[model samples]
Target: MKNRIWIVCLACLWLVNNGVFSQEVSPRSVFSLNEGWECRPITTVSKKALFTPVTIPHTWNTSYSEGTILYDRKMMVYQRPLEITNAMKGKRLFLYFEGVNSAAQVFLNHRTIGEHLGGYTAFCFEITDQVKEGENLLEVWASNAYRTDILPISGDFNICGGIHRPCHLIVTGQDCISPLFYASPGVFIHQENISEKEAGIRVETHLSLKNKKEGLKLKTTVTDADNKVVANSETAVTDSIVKQPMLVNRPVLWDGKKNPYLYTVTVELYDGNQLKDRMVQRTGFRYFSADHEKGFFLNGKYLNLYGFCRHEDAKGKGSALLPEDYKMDMELIKESGATAMRLAHYPHAEPMYDLSDENGIILWTEIPMCGPGGQAFTGLVDTEGFKENARLAVKELVYQKFNHPSICFWGICNEILVSDGKKFVEYDDPIPFIKELNGLYKSIDASRLTALATCVDQSYYLGSSDLIAWNKYFGWYKDAAPSASKFFDDCKNTSKGIPVGVSEYGGGASVNHHQWPLAMEDRADSHFHPEEAQTFCHEGNWESFAKRPYLWAKFIWVFADFPSYMRQEGEVDGYNDKGLVTQDRKIKKDAFYFYKANWNLEPMVYITSRRFVKRDNPLTDIKVFTNLKEATLYINDEKIGTMKPDEMKRVIWKDIKLNEGRNTIRVEGKNGRGFLSDSCEWYYIGK
Candidate 1:
């Protein structure tokens, strides 16, 4: 394999003493660096690949195989010019990249500034000493090559390379908030004795100043949703921080999905009564605790978390998604009545956290230190210096997302031993690695708890974290329902310890594949993965989950089908078809509505297998997932007696005779508040 780097910026014109700007723009300014970037792969053999235009938050994998992992693991070089004036002589300038994956080598004026490992976290470089008052070159080399030291060691997802996230140029005065720590907001809010009546909030602000300045004051104000000031405090920047407390008489609680009220906290820096810098942060007041016996209690209400895990990949876009994509995904999850979500295996884009906050959806986010040895072929080998890389990823994930009220738990690891059976080499135990990561998380933020996701055969490791989650595929893999009852019975008797939950569970199915007779046995390894099998698996799993009130949370394996290179079992060769929704997100599988019927409070009725139109049976067991108590079924204009839903919210009408041709089946019912109606057309051929 040949290695090369592209000289992306062919001609970076510099500002000539430069008349571009008269005065040094504004003090402490931040500008978007999304434009004027030209890039080309090092293997470019023609003028077409010679310094082509590209944008920030881009990926070279856009042109690669969307259905599988045939992505080109090449290096992409990006460059842009920065215009500086004489007024910025004393101020410090910094460049911030929200995320860049496998690795990034940053340069200024053709000199290497620094390099960052791990593609999912934010990093910044201080360039005040290297930048000039005119045009300067800002070049970066990014790659998605598989390395021995990065996490994901191996997973079912595609890792694309580029400056795949937003980048910005930040300018700050000598006395301002510090952007040194993972490019995070310098302020951290700590709430104590939190409730509706009264609460205490401590504001911790870290500042970076050029010199020892005098008469610098930090003013803080807490405002509610109505823009009314609730609490106010101000103090001098005697040191690098101004830690103070603000007490409110009555606070509005940020209840999930019910009422997601948010409050804005603004911080201002003043030098001798002149405002120097300002930062506005949004947060909400809420408190939650989990019990293995009572499930999760948020703001003194038992709110069961019926959620699903989400991946950041999209069709043809790879990991590079727009704000509109985020909104659409958020709306879909919200529409499914998912009260919580697990940002699986890694930290998602920052915008997702905000979307969760706005929609009142609880989040369980984690670093990419997942599944034994990180990637494939290691069989549980932590060869990538996973502990250190994980340390940095954890720091970035917590700090950048600390203020978001939607975040409920921090995941330390996921199925670290899922491949423990394939261990071909001797390796250190993962128990200590997970424990140290948990300790590191505790040292920074104690406001939230940390959890670990593990597959079966790792229950003994549950004592390492604040919470434990298991990814079991009992029905799909073991040909039976999940052992949630045994798990709860074994762990629920404890006094007050870690709570348990189901992190990943579901059978895979392609939207186009269907099993007419709904055979539920000996089909685990079937190449013709059927949509009906996925529906059956979900029904049994939900039935188990509904009975076990001791379980705290349940995050389905995935919400959408995602890309995977090594996957060949499902109908799609290069994708994981475990998602409840299709890869294109154009159709929701029957399993999606199974959970909706149980979780959604709205009056709804839907006949499962509406997409399984072709059938070869005279007698069919028609199933309708409905919140309605009693629903009447009619086939070919003939009533089939009204039936009440079972405890699982399912109305099953068995042995329904179908017509020779297309048959119209309709179901109508009324719930506590409204009426529900559903109809499906099925073509019946001779059995």
Candidate 2:
């Protein structure tokens, strides 16, 4: 009878594995801890009531109206408890958080397990040891009380509290791959001297493995498009420990636009003949360099850089988005004719790196030290606090994202080293801090170039970075609206030998929604005119805002505004309407169309702004912004004539006729440095 029972159990297991019980299992599970959370003053907690209900992605202080709030508020403490059951016993358990504002201390079953100090960057801790077979308790204590030691305490943007992102309890195999590791197993490249047809190809492969005790083994086989083996090799490892420096040679070459060849590298791990894990990395073979005197080069060919800064926030969800959202953003970025993206103030969601790797978009990833403020503001200065936070950010960012081929630059800060009035005290020189930060970045990721954004004149700090990038608001933030040409000239003149680029520009605009006549008085601190600010409130129009700058190949900063609590009186409460799309993700503003015209590289027509068309005006004069140097207009296929835009903001196309039937107007612009086109169709009743 015991033998029969064992046989029945084995049969049941087989059926379950083969889908007989598939309906009972799922690919993923949602564990929502949004409810049953509570918060109280930190001073009120006692030993007996150590655990309390608290909401995640929450902050300690919600009282500040605007500006930086840097006071020690120990009175407020947040707590949350979770109960775990036996189903989570043997499996590897991971507590994953998208973000925990400021610093957090976590306890499981009354024992301290893990702690994190950074507000951004996703982190996880294994909790299997702390949990029992039956009921288990999880407690978290979060503090947003300001500390001079924290790096972001001095910068712009509100340190909103609570778990700003979703939390998850991941359960996987003991050897499951880490969520953020580069998915590409490894990359191969072939670099040939242009003069010599017989070029040597180099192959490099990387893998994230578990069960290192059994050792990792790499097996590489290269084949042509026809599946014919051209070369192959195998490496055996007797030890499982991962060495800091891993290297492999003779990789296949990946070239930019001219010769976009790529090779595949396959790596596998083994534990005494038992297959442990496997991964494949696709890489290209090419050695490129960027220089102050010569610009950027790839495979010995000189190329200009054209790109934009991207934020991770999505419509409706705020910053809490899934992998698909990142993928879609990349798709639109690629379609916009941008070859690169600066991940903005911080390292972006992990999936962004994967998309950049696959799509070949160059990346400039940076830490969260954005805007101005330093020791003067937080009394933190360049002390241990700054060093520790910088070190942690660099280590995590490099370790998790270094392998992506698309990552070409690592920025230390975005205009933070300089002293702005917002700080409590001022320093005569910011060069020392800049040098220290740049040195730290170089030490961490020697493979990538280092850069920073400087709002103040940085002639003295130019030597600190490999490339000189400045976020000049001469036209936007500052009162002086310098010509686009003059702006580039100013950067060049100030940079001297250093290669200069405009990292941020463009004014904000709201879409469809006209600014309240009182908006100017209400938002006195805004950089652009009320009408211009309204134009950016939609999608596509923000693209137009980026056009003139892209002509030089190094301008970015076309943004879809991020949500911030730094609102002044008379402003909208929840959303910052300067984004290409509204916070809710509806309405594509006029600037979005301008960007689509310049970046899409296709013939398209879009309406920029309708404000000029008053309620009583039936015929609205449209200002079509195109990257095309020369254009010809055709209405219903009838050749209208060559067109040129005049200083008065009108495109001249003489003697064009219109009819009552559905009519189409197309204008094709000549492509100079970038592509540009636009069109419009109107129905005529009787005139």
- Highest lDDT: give the candidate number: 1
Clashes (N, CA, C under 3 Å) per candidate:
9, 69
Predicted candidate 1 versus true structure: per-residue lDDT over 413-466, tens digit per residue: 886663244642344577877888899888988878788877645555766788
Query: What is the per-residue lDDT of model 2 for residues 309-361, given as tens digits with 9 covering 90 to 100?
Result: 76756654445456677776766676556677788777776678777776777
Badly placed stretches (over 4 Å) of model 1 are: 1-27, 43-49, 62-69, 85-91, 372-384, 418-426, 491-496, 522-525, 671-675
My TM-score estimates for the predictions, one after another, are: 0.90, 0.70
Cα lDDT computed for each candidate against the true fold: 0.81, 0.55
Q: Which window of ten consecutive residues has the lowest lDDT sum in model 2? A: 182-191
